[model samples]
Target: MKNHSGHDMAGHNGHGGARPGGLSVSENGYTLEFDSTIFSAGAQTVTFRVTGPDGRPVTEYTPEHEKELHLIAVRRDTAGFQHVHPVMDEKGTWSTVVTLEPGDWRFFADIHPAGHDGTMTLGIDASVAGPYDPRPIPEATGIARIGEYTVALGGELLPGEASELTLTVSRNGRPVTDLQPYLGAYGHLVALRVGDLGYLHVHPEGAPGDGSTEPGPEVTFMAAAPSGGTYRFYLDFQHNDVVRTAEFTVRTTAVPRPDTAPGTAPGHTNHHHAHH
Candidate 1:
């Protein structure tokens, strides 16, 4: 039985009635459980649970991006991408089984609580038990100008390793300021790794205050690639009541880290060489 507040208000499968408190999945972190035993070669069943922050059952919460909860899963090497709708069973547990391949993958849970200012983001990395090299990042290219935005990209990302992307947006051949708010954040960036088009939803770091009346021109986004492979990036922004989009193609390469000299950090980019 689903509650009017959008929370599953029923008991099921050894689980009791709706309880208070939010669910978490990290050890030494939140209490939500991500049971992966349901995963298999072809058809897979995955179950997750959620609660409130006060240890009580979460009845009704705010919906972000038009959904109560958005779960995005993708194989580590850009093999599979699934945007799933999880059903909240009577016992307050959300479960869904998807057909998938055996490989390393990552999962992201996007949640927004009622009366909260921003959405809560969480991620988990898992392996399907196979031969995989979770190194090397992807490279991004095909940057084009869309209206007042200039977008460029590069990088290759493997599973588990953090994917760092640098997007430079400008207007009038100069850095743009006065960026307007779009999608509850400064900017909205959507990434789909090639082959399967796995989805990576991201938002900018800074946002305008609640009562500020401002507009914008240029924006930048730093996003993590969820897996290794070629990825397509779409950045959306608004100006003068019109929305603009910038597209770029990025390739992920599996290059091992070089042994730097003593006192030199790893993976550091030297901008001086590019300028010369």
Candidate 2:
């Protein structure tokens, strides 16, 4: 839901248009207005409201993926990424607590109003006051290690289409077969473009309770990329009653030119980087 915009083409991400969610404060008559954009570095409750075209609070929203709204906050350097759901009051104010550090932050609100025809993802920036030490962005990788778990990614991403992606989970080099369900699925995958932190729509292939879906070792997802570029993927899965996320950075494959001879490589290439 974070990628909706007239300019948002899941397969053609680089086309010029309205930026992805978290890049604009207002879109399509809906505004993502926060009570304050400057906050102290610590645990704090951030409050924001959505105003409709009529300049009034929007109180009714249709739920997507079992949540009315998804809030994603990440540091500019991609050092900190947190996806949380906020509670809304009658006044259309949504509030949630998040730990902040010194630096710039990006906030993406993915929502769909009850009366609206489709979902809208709006973006805004918040400045955290403190010693702003920036973090460096790492190279793309297909593997990520969190604690004792290791996740290996397989499959290629093509623009303008739902690419099949398979994620395998292991612990201490042993395959995990009893993974618990997270958010009604065996796993949840989030894709964000490298430069702008543009959110991409990613859907899991099947549900946890489905007879054909397995609990662990292999979790499949269908992801669409708007353009060829560096993209970071986060997979959330639960094992041993603990939930953890695996991070991987990948580049989409390039299309072969019509004039290019057979077996000739295209101008674009794919790269994978694993985060430890």
lDDT of 1 at 238: 62
lDDT of 2 by residue, 221-246 (tens): 75556556777777778898887988
Residue-level error in angstroms, candidate 2, position 47: 0.5
Question: What tens-digit string does per-residue lDDT give for candidate 1 at 1-276?
Answer: 221122222221112122211122431222455766335567677787655556644445577645677666666664455656677766657777766677776666666656655554455666564455543434444566876557555344332223344555567687656566665655666566565444456554445675642334434333433334576566666665666776666665534234333443222224211210
Q: Which of the numbered candidates is closest to the native, going by highest lDDT?
A: 2
Where is model 1 more than 4 Å wrong at Cα? 1-30, 129-139, 143-200, 203-276
lDDT of 1: 0.51
- Please report, in order, the local distance difference test score of every candidate based on alpha carbons: 0.51, 0.74
TM-score of 2: 0.83
- Give per-residue lDDT, candidate 1, residue 143: 66
Candidate 1 lDDT at 65 equals: 47
Which stretches in model 2 have alpha-carbon errors above 4 Å?
A: 1-22, 253-276
Tell me how candidate 2 scores on lDDT: 0.74
